[model samples]
Target: MNKFGVSAQTLIAAAFGAAIMGSAFAVPKLLAPEAGAQPIAIQAPPGAPLSFADLIEKVEPAVVSVNVVSTQDLSELGDMDQFFEQFRGMPGLEDFFEQRREQQEQETPRTREARSLGSGFFISQDGLVVTNNHVVERATQIQIVMSDGREIDAELVGADPLTDLAVVRVKEPGPYPYVKFGSSKDIRKGDWVVALGNPFGLGGSASAGILSADGRELGAGSPYTDFLQIDAPINRGNSGGPTFDLKGNVIGVNSQILSPTGGSVGIGFAIPAELAKEVTDTLIQNGRVSRGWLGVQIGDLTPEFAEALGIEDVKGALIADVTTGSPAERAGLKRNDIILSVNGQKVTDSTSTTRLVAKLIANTKNKFDILRDGKPQSISVTVGERPADPNAISPVPGGANPAEPGAPSAVPGKMLPDFGVRLSPMDDATRIALGLRTGDTGLAITEVTKGGVFGEAGFEPGIIILDVNSRPVASVDAFERAIAEAKAANRSKVLLGLRVGQVTSYRTIDIPK
Candidate 1:
């Protein structure tokens, strides 16, 4: 008001008038009581409970806090002499540096006891407790703290890292309060769930929220688990806890959460009870779970891949490379074959196929329906036990040595300006570098024009084009013939099988009209 050159008294009077008017209209509407209006009260929807206290009391006894003590190496801390070198020549600093050097020289390999906490629940009357594999991994000693403050020693019965589940047995046996796994399939999206655990080392904590979603895949770490997403506030110590349904049945096991602040953001994941129960049962019986192995590198059949392959539906797993001597190779499965179904179960994608195959019994004959060379065929093969370390099985034998000695340095090639790529005939040096076996024919990429179609498709020099539309291509003329045939058939896309590094994969490229 002062800067606008208006009188202070007048401005104050005007502001007072506006405030009076605003309050005159807003006060009655917001705060004034109406004669017949009952006091406003929020009510829960019909059938919803006002509180979860009853459910909490019934299931809290089964919940326990898992205390783990493990060893942590501190040997790296003994190398600090280099940091004090500049101060060595300073006045009156010689004694300090000498003492520090002596301490470092006297120090041996050091270690410390690291303590961590998680949660778990009893699953049987004979003291069979189920928790997460991570909770007890590398643990030198494990202690279970009960809800009533009773401490008991426990021994690891079995642990499955793939599913992040483990079973432990109490040293002193008794009829413990245990919970049973319920059917996660019956839980709807909006169904209520109660998570009981020890969050932040606070024992006997409980949280309730609706099931946010189901069948959420959280990347490669949990490839076999289709996690159930929940809005419950689960923190660090909540891992291995139980997520219970309204009927006090354990439906899921809290495993991970998505948060940037290291706290709950209402996005948490749980392993469904069905898978948990199955894995726990297997661990109890065999101390480990054995999965079926098919020995094939598979990928999802995307729309572009489907169109290039002349398939109508993109709902199967595409075989990229079949490992030599694997069950798949023994069964006559090959690269570029699309797996349609496994033992009458429709293959949806690579993940679904992986889960289905893992559920199969090892050494049992299983039927596989596949589309090979645009024709449907059936094959039977006995599933083999999956290797404990998945990386033990190489997709293909031999290593690439692109710069082999005594090889030709230059070779004649073809340049496709329209596609923005130069193709060269595969030489012995390139074959050895690509780890290709004998009789493998292909054209190698020599150069790619930046911002061109091939370059935009991620084609790089040294990549070997193995096949075009499932037809092996050895020369530029063969490639041209395959493209001409595709154009003649009115195909808009062509599938190219490529060998990059030591592995092989398929990519589809668009054809210009």
Candidate 2:
């Protein structure tokens, strides 16, 4: 078993399940259906619908198969001499290898048309369709196959890679059947959800399952979206299809699946309708989305951190570092401030805080409630437009060059036995190398004993200890004084503000009692 207590699996984008073509075979006469044969009937479980045929029929027409054809450059395929080398001495295989090489040499085409399949559904009568961005993002040509086998050429309208959603319009206009978005927030765990898609290129396939979970963050790839988890057996070629409630309203869009094999193992995720609808509308109106930027690196307030801060509840985001000249910096936001809320909405964690700030309109004043030095305060900041490249706003800090003439080198300092680390006073050279402000003061970690408390807690050499229990520590003496004060206060742990490389963060260390 893996760390998650389940078998290791891969998260696959459900977009391209290749359809296998097979030779036809004759059927036995004995296997043929008898005249006036009746369909098999199965007893329904309690509280279950007798059949989903009616619901499937109602929504099947709007669902479509997205066919994408893009050019693939094959010039990168290197020589095949090594591949043919293995068969040189094999019995009766020399001729086969030579023939293959000759055929490969004769083929001079450098590019080929690659076809991929996915699913989508019309969202308007004028042929506006919703699908995953990956489905048609690279398509040189797109075709939508309807339920009745009618093929209509389509063009990409707009796509949002952050949310993995896209809008496409059919070139041939018509009064098409479409589906409407429903409130995904109202859907509860265990509520029945029917997924309609073209799984494995099988057009108009439907699978029934419950909403396994909601508000799930897959990873860093989809920071803006909190995916709705389902067990609807959606598979490849199902990307961008709609998951419908019993009312035939689209509540989610099928996007990905977690499976040991490429096929679905029942764990699937979809984009919630609320976020999807919002992004779709914006894409339809604008070619791209522009999010608000707060310009602060934040971390979750853990229970240990709360104890250090003398707080009863650990329910806020800890501001680690504020960008220079950012909206946050201009609003007087500082390091170590705990964000309690944004615009009156209570901040739950770092992720929620990021999402909240991103939803704010650019150039608009927003209220932020924060806790500084155990006191509550509110500040108003005019949000700015997020940079096109997220990293452009907060690039990774460069490493220090101790070899430079004026760079500070590690010096022997007082050792904190309990923490198994030595501290040295920060100097002008160290501050400049760290790219810190002139007034910034801290005790740099000179050495960390392996397998000791500090090392186990992730403390390492070159890290600077900025504060102890919110008190600035400018030297080894100050760090010792703060530790003594914490011990005198009978605190079990003390929070330390640390500057690791260029990023600021907080870590709680146990106070030896």
Candidate 3:
């Protein structure tokens, strides 16, 4: 009986083991699709794949890690901080903040070695790399590292601060992988994109995202400044990297982000490939970019102004001032004229108009459509080279006459009133009272009339007026000179450059002539 029981148990054990083995073999066969059959014909909905593995495989080799090393002298850091802080207000606290920040940066070392790591990509097989100008701006040494762990020294070929792009060159030439430029204009919102960069200095890092927005203006930070905003995970070291389309084309160059915590908030900005490509080409060809310029100071058309001019809406850039002898003035672009379009393309804002005009080849004759007194007018003007000095105010030659000695005291008629501030010449006492440095020069306000033009214009008694109608006014004489020129020209508004506290700023006001 015992022998019979043992035999039965052994047979049952053998049967159970065979069943388990058979189940394992059956499961794999069932899960694996048959070679002759398809994936059940499951339809992938119309959109990009949820995974970026294919993108990484296609674009990773084109991306490179950029390492920059710069030196910051202790005194220079203190001075730069002080200079910028003065413009941000709290002039008295400038030195205090600088000292504290310098100490902190020195002790804990925000960047003692002055090392910055960013990402860039090859534009040509001969080892030409394109990146953000800020990435390698002050770097004394630059190292480019490839994906296969090859490091090589790179030389800065050229950089354009206005467009925020830099070009660098590596010594070795090869059948190097690179990306072709794509038209950013064709990219709409919600387009799939893959960002390749060295995020946190981790080489060959990639993240996929979509174009969240386009034509984002960051507010006068750069001259040629239409940016494509993306929701990619671009971090500190991601600047200068390439944002690639699904076809592995370089669509944009990742530039900036709106982050307060110094980390990726998934809102990254890219210089559109359209803009970057032009700059890169110029840099590669001439070692610098030459941008065309139409010399005019423009203002956003306000509702009141638009209605006054019989414009249906604020749709065009209003000409506030035209530089004397400049292309605009030469082409008869008068003050108060609304710039409706540039080269026949409607301009809705200053940024778009500026960008359009910039893209014009230098010395090319372009047509500017304008609206004056409710009538459309066309003016032809030749675009000229942008002035090298942004700070040098264009002079209004013979625009004002010298006030006759012993003449009746002329008071401006229709003295629009508000805060009762008056314009006067800057003196030692006034400068000391206003806490102005010796280098400061402008028409200082000594007193205020109750609700007068000075008040209406948002002027304070201690404020110094530097420029009127885009013309520099270093003294009371120059201020009066500018006012006379505006009256003679029948202009109703003037833009003033001001030096308040310790920093230079600008404001626009309407002056009834």
RMSD of each: 7.8, 13.0, 13.2
Model 1 over residues 391-434: C-alpha lDDT tens digits? 56644345223343222225758888878888877876666665
lDDT of each: 0.86, 0.85, 0.74
lDDT of 3 by residue, 34-56 (tens): 66765454565567787889878
Highest lDDT scorer: 1
TM-scores of the models, in the order given: 0.84, 0.79, 0.65
The candidate that achieves the highest TM-score relative to the unseen native structure? 1
lDDT for 508 in candidate 3 is 60
Once model 1 is optimally superposed onto the true structure by TM-score, how far is the C-alpha of residue 27 displaced, in angstroms?
A: 8.3
lDDT against true structure, model 2: 0.85
* Candidate 1 least-lDDT 10 residues: 400-409
